[model samples]
Target: MDKKLLEVLACPVSHGQLFFHSQTNELFCPASGLAYPIDAGIPVLLEAQARPLTEEEKQA
Candidate 1:
């Protein structure tokens, strides 16, 4: 993912900062407890597309 693009990208629902998870290819919003998927290098920032984070993932 491009650093510049990532810097400007925020959670669509909460408008919070996102942390990229390389292993899962997802962008996580700690504040929202959501993980937005990245497919083909494109971030699917839609709230409907986001999945709730597991408790373990939250601690990580």
Candidate 2:
């Protein structure tokens, strides 16, 4: 993922900062407890497309 692009990207629902999770290849918003998938290098920032963070994921 491009650093510049990631810097500008925000969670669609919470409008919070998103951290890149290389292990899962997704952008996770700590504030919102949501994870947005990156498909073909494009982030799917839609709230509808986001998945709720797991209990373990939140503790991480």
Candidate 3:
């Protein structure tokens, strides 16, 4: 993910910062407990497209 783009993007739910997890190829929002997916090198920031973070994922 582009660091510059990540810096500018915010979670649709919380409007909080998003941290990109390379392993999952997804952007995680700690505040909103949502994981936004990246499709074809593009971020799917839509709330409907986001998945809830697992409990284990929250800790790590």
Candidate 4:
């Protein structure tokens, strides 16, 4: 993932900053409790495409 891109990426729904999760290959929005998946280097930012964060994931 590109550091510059990650720096500017925001959650589509909450408009909050997104943190890159390299191990999961996803972008997490703590405010929204959503995880946007990255597919082949492209981010899937759609709301429908995002998955809800598990309790453990959110706490982490």
**19: Cα error in model 1, Å:** 0.7
Off by over 4 Å in 4: none
TM-scores vs. true structure, each candidate: 0.93, 0.92, 0.95, 0.94
Per-model CA lDDT versus the true structure: 0.93, 0.93, 0.96, 0.95
Give the per-residue lDDT of model 4 (tens digit) for 1-60: 899999998999999999999999999999999999999999999999999999999999
For candidate 4, what is the TM-score? Answer: 0.94
On TM-score, the leading prediction is 3
Steric overlap count per candidate: 0, 0, 0, 0
Q: Where in model 1 is the C-alpha error above 4 Å?
A: none
Q: What is candidate 1's CA lDDT for residue 18? A: 96
Clashing pairs in 1: none
Worst 10-residue lDDT window for candidate 4 reads 1-10
lDDT for 49 in candidate 4 is 95
Candidate 3 C-alpha error for residue 2, in Å? 0.4
Q: Model 3, 1-60: lDDT tens per residue?
A: 999999999998899999999999999999999999999999999999999999999888
The ten-residue window of minimal lDDT in model 3 covers 7-16
